[model samples]
Target: MTSPLANPLNRRLLGASALALVLSASGQAFAQTTPQTDETDDATTQLSLGKIVVSAGVEKIATDTPQAVTVLNQDDIDDTQASTIGDLLDDVPGVYTAGGASNLGQTFNIRGMTSNRGEVLMLVDGVENYFEGYRMGAFFSEPELYKRVEVLRGPSSSTLYGSGALAGVINFTTKDASDFLTGDDRFALRTRFGYESNGDGKLGSIIMATRPTEDVDLLIALNGRTSDDYEDGNGDVVTPSDASANSVLAKARYYIGGDRKHSVWASAQVWESDSYQLYDQITGFTAFGTVRRRTRDEAFAVGYDNSFEGNDLLDLKAQVSVSETLTDQDGIALASSLGYASEYSYSTVQARLENTSKFTLSPDWTAFVTAGLQYYSQERRNPRYKADGSPLSNGATTHPEGDTTRYGGFVQAEILWRDKLVITPGLRIDHTELSPGAGVVVGGGSTAVPEDATNTGYSPKLAVLYNLTDYLNVFGSVAHTERMPILDEVYSRSGTAPVNLNLDPEKSDNYELGASLTLRGLATSSDRLNAKLTAFNNTVENLITSASATSGYFINVGEAKYEGFEVEAEYATRSLFARASYATVDATNETTGVLLNTRPADELNLNLGYVLNSLDLTVGWRGEFVSGITNYNATTGAVSSTVDSYNVHDLYATWRPRSGSLAGMDVRVSVDNVLDDYVKNNLASFAGQGRSFKLSLGKTF
Candidate 1:
């Protein structure tokens, strides 16, 4: 008889478990046994306006940072009742989702730049999530698995995050055992079940956490979901949209050294999905048939963090991670006994190390410096198979079997003057090399030799913030960023072999100005108001764009420009809260004097909520609006289409008992698209979901 772990999938799980054990053992051997104080606890206890560690320079309070940043806590995540990444980001200003309904093709558009070609960088716990190939998606993880999400807008992030962040960065921080074991309990368990009417979706999740000792903690979670095809506003079923997904996550942490100054952690997550998409048959081609698609994604990471007790100069953090995404497509011709299959795989491995130091320049002035190094590599491969499970001799992969390697180093400094003024400056340099494999075939049925290219980039950023009063601050920033061409842009084949090996790196100059105000006791003794306004101008040179619709090659567009403004405000009291945000962008191709394709339209979001503490009940309402947008023709550079503007509304309520037989239990209900309004996204090809209701129940012990 064989053990259950003997199976391949179980073996992988056991391997991840063993790796966590090894990390724990190593931390215990190198660290001194002492009671550890969790830094996250201290951070959580601070007011919302306190220091933020996700900024460009050293950690600083929100009022001191010169960029537009948004932080969403767990409570915000729960209130939205989101089923996909797009749903989760709908309310964020200056950001838009491009794909329709499916998780496999979704991408983000930030400011006037988009991630369709990997302009925006996605990070999970400081580890890079690489996207490659045409059908690839962003890092999609279960919302319940995260504690918070931080979005940094603009190109200044290049100094800290390196390449692929020409637009900005989105970072996700996962939950830990301490998040669930809030009290003195040694063990805790949480279970959740939810349903959505639009897709007839049902979901179940379980989380378990344990603190075996004062210095060790462990957490494990599993989630599963299944959904059917959903209906549009017109009461028509969205074809081939059914799906089933599952995710597994495990994390471990060990605290070592005196006063818990040293810490080590390891985390592993695996997500898999099976879904179908409709492919209409060609008018004259009998072999064309509907296709079925399946996708699987997995990510794993390990990290170490340490802080010195007696010294303020040597805090260290390091991480290494690897991720892979695989997609398979099968097509069967309904009119004949014919079938075909193809597979695509993308993978990445990355590592990072950083050290931070702080010094007291004077009684009222302090300074900090951060320096880091990063390295990563990515590879993509595609293979085609015949209906009889045999290989096609003439078949060729898309984008080539190539890999990209990047190495970078950066340093940033933050200085305070008289505790009323702050200045931040940073610089980064990166070297990248792209190597393609041999035996590649071009579109014209000719073999092309592989080519290698190397490029370098320099990024510089400076920002300043001045406190005008106790409740008001003004800030400004200017930065220069450069992006090297990605694999697909340079290696994608055209007729016979027109490889672009001499393409120059795209360059951008960005400028921003913003202000923030925090007012306490605005109307009542406990009322608070926070507001922010920001404006930006960005110009890009040597923009890489496709040459023509018929040509697969890429060329450098002369220039492009993006200008935008954003406004956000929130007012909160003991029992009531209200918030609103608006963003507008004007983007154009400078050389052609025409609007960019699929440019994001003006957006507005508003929310209001009230809590009845006495009854343990809460109710809220949310609204979103997007203006009409114009689309441009790729070859003719003319207006080809327009998407009409639309509006959506949602309502939600929650009941949780603080102290009773139902204590530690919560029930939530929501109605989305309350009016059953017909709506279409500015960039998506399909219509948005119609009126729907959601219900969720959860309990913790």
Candidate 2:
């Protein structure tokens, strides 16, 4: 399945985005001044074969990439100065935030789509970081350790990656020891402490270093924390006693640079994502306590990328990896006096390669084409059946088995038509195999076979940039994307149909047209002001939605359409900076003709920051107004679960002492749910966290 780009809603994202860009500009301008570079960092950013890369976001490359991408750098992390994975995600437009009720597992939503359903992909270095629970969030890695975050938004990304890119990709790049390591005996450390209105206390520290001739680079980091249940303005306890945890991360990198351009490196990690919610209901605030989960995950691999100069100039890279995760979920419904428990074990092995060359077709144009293939396989298990935290017994015990296989290849090419115009078009094709174990009845019951299916999908994307002038660009794009049904979807088939496949691939088209304007900073600004306007129309085919109310089986309703606009603007100067974004979505279900459930129609984000040599403080807040929504019963024509509009806020600050050698060291703090809004998040899923605060310290040597 392939979707076309939204020609109408493209304007919406561009328009709403302006609100964020404006605040970001001013925020940076007021923060601090260093070198005369494209960034606000103390170190200058350079361009070369592989000059130190800024993954947070690569500007010209971001604009030139065939897909729509966003970047949030370490500075952005520091400015917002967040403590949890959920806090950093605010920079991403169209993404839904979760896990606020507890610091356990926060889920992210993209384009009104869910993550951890294997819909979105999260990669750290080269390993997948996200796992499944009731909710989804980043792996147990410290955000302060990151250098940058790149978000590739959309299924058109499937060609580059396989299974999970259905909603696009989030590539998290970690800071290399050498990038910050200094002196023959390198060493650096950071410590932090914080307090919250909910009686939450946090303390942590990290230490890193390397040995010159020992052929070993070592890093050690840890985070220890504690928190209590919080009461919102409405006077209700959100999840409390979110099990405090002690986490540690270690790494070792060896140098094999005998071949100069030829080198190989590998790393491994084992971490825990655990949480215990003391309260049951956060929506209206529940009295049910004692909810918990624990996930032990480990990923380790070795890969090599070698470059060779030949007639065609080929750069070859390949890697094979084995990763596994074990998750234990436990919950007790106080009212029902029911305790439910289940576990899932997953292991995956994958390999991939790519070859690319730049061709000098003509004096006025250049072309680069890339081709690659990736394979992924996994085994999953689910033993008990439950609905809305309630036990459901039919045939008694249920053990479901499932595995996935994906083989795909894609090629992207760019044509530079003179110095001002560029065009990029890419296409990918994939073949997938989905197989699940048959179901058996408990204690000598009947046995039934589960159906399996194979599918082939294609994704294509195109982006054009026409530079009206040196500082302005007008661009347009159209693309198609798709994703096969995931493991859970196949296991939970509806109505016991004698079907080969339970559902069709979800397909969508995002069309866009937008413009960017760069203006000179007004004050003693060493930076530039940016303004963007975009309108877009997003159409999804075979939109699949499930419900637990009626043994919620996955079903395809009909076509769904979402149209919107976004505006983003920013101003960066030496003394002050500001950035802001605003988005309005008009989403509708064409068949039933009702507002899409949980799809917010209006959203706004704002951030303002200022840096006073010894102290760099920032205040930021985001507001989302979920318009009224109703669920329609296909046969009865009855509407259920009506929701109202609401808003949320957050505040952050950082302090750096100028007098001591601790120049690069600073303290950062943040408070989420400032107003303590008691907004019912997902009625079927769970509630959100109450007002909470976190503090962290960072240093560079």
Candidate 3:
């Protein structure tokens, strides 16, 4: 079989062709309103062009950010009725998930970089969620706990997020008590229930929000879910897909100095699941046999914010957070041969202090400078036990234990000239050190300790955006960043490869160009349309990757190149809305000219909906199309088997009443995979979910 969108040149032409048509059509429309930096009200802030991005060092509207960015609000999250966090982001352009059908195995991929390689940064309420292990995945949390998610694509984010953000950054914001409070009401209680037919999945949740004092607000939420193994489109049961999980979220906020400008807040979240499943969660089943596994993930954070109302140069925010993820497995059928049951854990502690200064530089120039300092420490541990419940004498080097410490400081400056041109420049410096755990053994059972490895790197970026006209804007950016080695790459010295102490940091140079189009008064006087197209090229030097288990351990090989394009457009009115996005990426190893397997297939997502104000009802249809890919190997001049293209469609309806007897009630209904077509994500290891009907009901008092 042959793939249609596999050639790099063809993909580039496709993007160019689409862009030419969009530009031509937009030129004929007249501009009605000019864009502004003023923030929109909460009720109307969900609009794609009006939404503000808090993850950026200095908040800016998504369209004015000069990067490929996406923001999903609470409404979007609820409409999907997603079971896992990954499901909430699957439709985002340039984003994909691997690890197959099990929720526990889902991991995120951006551009062509996987999260396991520390290329993509994941954060929850400003705290890092870092975990990497064999056959396991990253980011295990409840999607119901979050109200907002922000995705900033490309290496330009490295200046604010971290050094390893070669692909991008994703930030999840938790819900607050204020989100549930209504006028004159000091307390609120909410109950929600949901069911899915495909896997017989059931979910129950309860939340309480209260204001004990005029200066304090508090909230607590509890959620539970259970499901059996689900069937694929062919009606075949996908083994090890059963799930039983519980989660809790608590948050509080307090005002100080009788002024809300000075406030403090804290939050805690915990999620856990215990069950018996296959030893290999990534691909489902293997010769390793099944095991009794229990997994726990927890995060806690505290923050302080002061507007400094009288001081224009002292607006400040500070935070400290800690997180831990642990997984334990016992009663393994192959415990004796594998040397025993084991426990794997990753713990992190982090802190950040940031401030933004806004001032006028001249009559025609306005500027804002943001500076921040961050520090984080992570530890990884793997302990094994004998079949008889005794400690193992020899440790496994395949997953060694280690500790990594990193600290960084960054500064960004944004300057606007006459409200038509914006320029942003940023710089960051980070230092990292890796230390092997005590008594850890490596290749050939050697006990000799190795010297600690340390490295320092810097990232710099510059971006410019110019408004060509009232309804069009062009932007370009250049960024250079670095990524330090993680614990696994530095400590694990197994599989016939010796320890390498001279490992160097991976460096990347990324470039991006894009255009934004905004038009109004086309279909109706109050309707608006917004679209953006972005093209990016990145080169990574000294790329770090595994050289196959039989050959060597993780090593810094030659360079790799990644190039891609993303197109996003949205149109909305009082009662009608439509959105569409398309994305494609091509990545290859420069040394052998072989296409990288991490590159995902081209994807297009579309949503069309209408609202009926009289009945307080909304209905929508969503469709997703994915093109297949064929891998190429230059060494042997061979082409690998291809993955067939597939398409999935969904229908949904939602009802919410604001007044009368049905006030404070919400109901949602959705049918997924309506055609029951056999589907498999190009990057996944197993088949996709089959046709299913889902219902969710909630009531607030």
Best by TM-score: 3
Those runs of model 1 whose alpha carbons end farther than 4 Å from true positions after fitting are 1-57, 278-290, 332-339, 393-398, 441-448, 548-552
RMSD of 3: 2.6
User: What tens digits encode model 1's per-residue C-alpha lDDT throughout 1-701?
Assistant: 12332233453344344334433433443322222112243212212333264745665555456887777776667766677767777888888877546554467889867776667777778777766544444455667777777778888787899754667887888888888886568999999899999989888989999999888889999988888888877788875556678888899999996476689999998878877654321111223534676777788888999887678999999999888888787774541222277676778898999998998988888888899999988877766668777864222433466778999999988888885798889899989998875445444344656568899998999988987766667999999988889877777665644657777889989999987765554455545555667788999899898663233466687988898777776656668877777777778889988888746777777788888879989898998766666778755787788767777889999998999789989899999989887777766656778899999999998
> lDDT of each prediction vs. the true structure?
0.73, 0.56, 0.81
TM-score of 3: 0.95
Ten contiguous residues with the weakest lDDT in model 2: 42-51
TM-score of 1: 0.88
Q: Can you list the residue pairs that collide in candidate 3?
A: none
Ranking by lDDT: 3, 1, 2
Highest lDDT among the candidates is held by which one? Answer: 3
Least lDDT summed over 10 consecutive residues: which range in candidate 1? 30-39
